[model samples]
Target: MKWVKIKKAEINEWNEKLKATHASFFQYPYYASGYTFFLFSKPLYIKLVNDQQQELGYSCILNVGAFPFKAGLIIRGPVFFKTNVDHRSSLIALKKFAVKERYTFLRVNANEPAIEELLNTDSEFEHKDYFPSYKGSQGIDLNIYYKPFDELLKSFRTDCRNKIRFANEKNYLFEKVKTSTDLEKVYDLFVGLGSKKKFSYRPLKSYTKIFKEGIKHELCSVYTASLDGRIICAAFIVKDSQSFTYFSGALELQNIPAKYSPANNLHYLIMQDCFYKEDRKIYNLSYSPRESGVYMFKTSFRPEEICKPGFYTYVINRKIAERIFSLQGKSISAIRTKLRSIIKLFNK
Candidate 1:
């Protein structure tokens, strides 16, 4: 019945070391959760916990600050999984914090999608059914999900499967990145791809720090696909106990190169190496751009469109903040769509 801000040092031991040392979403050391990616706007993160005794079913949240109009607050995730009644207690505690903090609405977009099983029966989330959804999830989920590699491959489009086989025949080297220096290559490839495709340069140092500190905390990781000792494709993965998301990626030399399109094959590699029959269960490909060939590429993999969750915003008045946030959300989505249109014009 009590909520307290866990000190940073203490928070590390719980989410970083303890969760990491024992169980994690991805087996690779890099996918840990608590590190700061962007240093400029530090997020106030929370771990919904039941540490009063033995705990179960709590979410870890990242408080991403208020939305413009000062009527909304955004949190990257409220990643909650229930293991016991404690989850309900934790959520109730968090609900109080949200209201007392005077945040008109809590905008939550899970880093990954909510599980169907949980939605069918999770009683922990008070506002689980309260918010209107913004979009459907367009990604592959691998948590508690496994099938024979042949079945998995058969599931992909012929072109995708063929690309993997072709890339393999070409003798491309796949290497896992382990150091800060390795990120320079990743950044370069990302920048090249972004420039060629007209997308903004992804914040590399923030990502690098995630990988570096993740290794320390066991949260962030990278994989590079190389040709003749030079990196051609690179991807960074994010993990928690329930999911592994390919967060950022790039390919240097392109024309939809077989070397990079074989990303599904790379995904297969991650399961074999990082997940390796662990409690970990989901692999998320992230949101499909939905307006371009990239979306076709994602859909060719056959990930089902699942209903995704959004953050809950409680308006002091039912209508005021809701309309404002709704408009803001639409405007933001429109801008992103426009940006993607511009980017796709140059995609190789």
Candidate 2:
């Protein structure tokens, strides 16, 4: 079998064929990469075919130019099938691509079955590790597979439900905002919540853009929390297939009474109706809350287990790409070690 580089003539054909092969976020049509981005980038598609030109395996790659160091990130990616194609060789090719472009480093998040499988095999990395990750497949699925409102809360810890009830007892009201003007109150409360939680501050522009897009594509929605007429909390969710992703949420802390927690109350209202009932999508609790306080709070809303793979596939660079990739490996290893020390110091 021989593998040939894919050109523009086969763009649509490649995507359509890959769709039938795997359930990968990197392959999904809506993501930044899947969309018209390929137009500007002109992705690289490799197909392992028989003499009859019958396709046996395929993958997609992008000769991407990254910022900061202005490195060329020729990613070997979007591998759908691997029966005949060699994983190590492909990775080596990826590295070669990096070196040819004179890139300082090569970054790849190959969507494979498991990272463990790549270890102990050929092409083992010396300076490779993980960074704080962004949830992908699971995030979208939460928006795709929705549960009915009533039954959705069955898994929530009793305390979480009680908190919602408590929020109601405190006379909090939920409203669906249809216009940007209506978002002001929700935005204020959300910002307040963010400050209280000591979380990162994202500009209003970001949330507004997401909310508008969600409405446009029917991909997700936003909800505002109120006590009578005064807004107290706000959240936005993105719909992905059958999953209702909990994009982000914020709640006022000090202004509200001690009887109820804003996050719990805000989440339940969305789960029971906005997402679960209205959207008919599954509720994603989002990143398994790691902060002790946040984890305690999220546990109240029991969730199902979802183990999703990270990265789509690995490609190695030849000659020059290999050296650049090696530098990247060393950098990642150093950063991970430093991060671990920081976490340790925080714990101490």
Candidate 3:
């Protein structure tokens, strides 16, 4: 088995035109934002082949540079196109590729249980397992996700059902954002929600670009809920051919009209919209941590908590560099969290 670095355009074709069943939206070229989201990203499209060079399997990787070190993020990938490809050998080849490419470590969110197990027990690699960012994602299987709109309403918790009904009674509007003007209204609400949560929000331009590009690719949709013409809730959803994921959502929980749940109503509308589109397997409600308010709220929707593969990092030759990278990563995260809290306090 051999690992070869292909052109970025080839990666795009492999993901977009070739359409690997196991690849997720994150592996797509547009999703990377071409270094606008991160400082630098190197696209790796490796094909596993024999002496005759017939295609066996392929892995899509984004090697992102974090100043002193590089990390390869494999999101639900290394899909084997042919059945004969050995999972363990392909993974071993990937590790060698990472080290050869001078990456400090490789972080993979593999799609298969066998790949996860290999990362955990393989002697050729050293790694640790963390809760997957995509794990515990609350989602509904569209096959039986809902009934008629009325039955769907009945499925929700009493309080939630009431909130949606109350919002409608009050003439609240649910809209699918289609223009820049509409997006601006939703983005403002999103930014406000970010401030309240105290997490750093991306620049407005970044979001604008993402929305425009995503729309062009038919991969993104924005939904909003409004009360008396004032926007109160907004959500961003992304999807591939099979899965619709709630990528981001924001709303004013406190200032919204009493007994009217704009957020819940918006979610209902979004799900309905996705369902109408036809080819959907999972309606991913996004990641939620244990014991958090968001987790509890998502649970009320009755979506299953699906546990998937998580992050696995295999360090390369530079132990000293790995230590430095690890320290810097933790320190930066700590400082950012503290800073966000400080900013929130001052704003209040």
Off by over 4 Å in 2: 1-106, 110-127, 130-150, 181-185, 273-281, 288-291, 305-307, 310-348
lDDT of each: 0.53, 0.51, 0.64
Residue 98 lDDT, candidate 3, scale 0-100: 80
RMSD of each: 8.2, 9.1, 6.6
What would the per-residue lDDT of candidate 1 be over residues 293-346, giving only the tens digit for each residue? 666666666665554544434344346355444544454446345434544564
What are the clash counts of all predictions, listed in order? 15, 40, 0
Q: Which stretches of candidate 1 lie over 4 Å from their true place?
A: 16-40, 47-59, 65-92, 109-144, 255-264, 274-279, 316-348
- Model 3 residue runs over 4 Å out of place are 18-20, 39-54, 66-68, 129-151, 253-255, 328-348
lDDT (10s digit) by residue, model 2, range 219-314 = 546777776677666777655444556766665656566557566777776766646455444666665445766556665666655544433322
Per-model TM-score, in order, reads 0.69, 0.59, 0.80
- The 10-residue segment of model 3 with minimum total lDDT is 131-140
TM-score of model 2 vs. true structure? 0.59
Shift of residue 123 alpha carbon in model 3, Å: 1.6
- Residue 182 accuracy (lDDT) in model 3: 83
Top lDDT: which candidate number? 3
